[model samples]
Target: MNIVLFGATGNIGKVILQEALDRGHHVTAIVRDPAKLSVQNPNLKVATGDLLRPASYEASLAGADAAIASVNDPDPDNVPKQAQVLLDTLAKAGVKRFAWVGGAGSLEVAPGVRVIDDPNFPPAWKPSAMGMVKALDVFRASKADIDWTFISPAAHIEPGERTGKYRVGGDQLLVDAQGNSHISQADYAIGLLDRLEKGDAARKRITLAY
Candidate 1:
């Protein structure tokens, strides 16, 4: 598959990039600074582009199979703004498939109780989390015929073991026997690739945990 990736230097984005290359898929890593990307692979091509500017990366979208965005702009608030632009750009390119690396905030802890609504939710992360929520709304409300999937990570995601194991759920938070919702960065990327390849969670929001 010819995959176009955004935010290839981020925590989750880097892992996902490696996973895609490991799977033998042709990938184009779109970034502002090509120098920041150190990975060199025959299947990898780095493209210089800005997410908000369609013309910057639209050329790279030609003949693409799908695009995945693990997007985190300098201003987290720009997530929603870029989302619309991204959809428009994809439509113009005739790329109907997209996958977004989503946040846990929007997942329901209980009926009508989102992770962001939890009293224990950190205030420091609210701004970015809310930005993800608005971006999600943009995806949901879009009239374009894009087959998009939003993959939300567990509540506590960080560098840890890959384990190559995980569980999946929709909208609601998934927890283990210990009642903790967590997934390693590696496993989260693994899940995203699995979802993309398997096409099991297309055009919907799904959470990953273990």
Candidate 2:
């Protein structure tokens, strides 16, 4: 498959790039600076573009079998706008399958309650978390002709081993025996790729954790 990706320099995006290449898929990455993407693979191509301006990378999406975005706006307030731009541009580019690396804040921790609503939710993370929450809302309400899937990572995601062992859930946050919700970046990439290949969660949000 020819896959187009945004935010290829990010922690999660880079991992996704590697995973796609390892599977022998043709990947075209759209980046603000191509130099940041150090991965070298015969299947990988880098395109210089801006996330806020779709025309900058609009051509890259053409003929793409699927488009994945792991973008996080440097400005927390702009996340939703950036997300909308990617969605609209992909629609215009005629890509049918779209996968988004979303946030866990919007996942329900209990009936009618989200993680961001918890009193213990850190203030520092609230802005970005809410931005992702808004992005999810945009995807849900949009009427675009696309098969969109939003995968929310666990509350704690960082550089770690790719055990490729984890669990999946819908809407609700997944937790382990110790009541912890976390997943390694490597495993998260595997989960996202799995969804892209399976096409099981059309127009729905899925959560990953272990």
Which window of ten consecutive residues has the lowest lDDT sum in model 1?
194-203
Model 1 residue runs over 4 Å out of place are none
Candidate 2 structure quality by residue, lDDT tens digits, 58-121: 8788789999999888677788888788778888889989999999999999999999999999
Cα lDDT tens digits for candidate 1, 1-210: 899999999988999999999999999999999999999999999999999988899899999888899988768889998888887788778886788999999999899999999888899999999999999999899876677889999999999997999999999999999999999999998999888877777679999999
Worst lDDT 10-window in candidate 2? 74-83
**lDDT for each of the candidates?**
0.91, 0.91
TM-score, cand. 1: 0.97
**Model 2, residue 192: C-alpha shift (Å):** 0.2
The TM-scores of all predictions, comma-separated, are 0.97, 0.97
In model 2, the Cα lDDT at residue 69 comes to: 93
- The CA-based lDDT of model 2 is what? 0.91
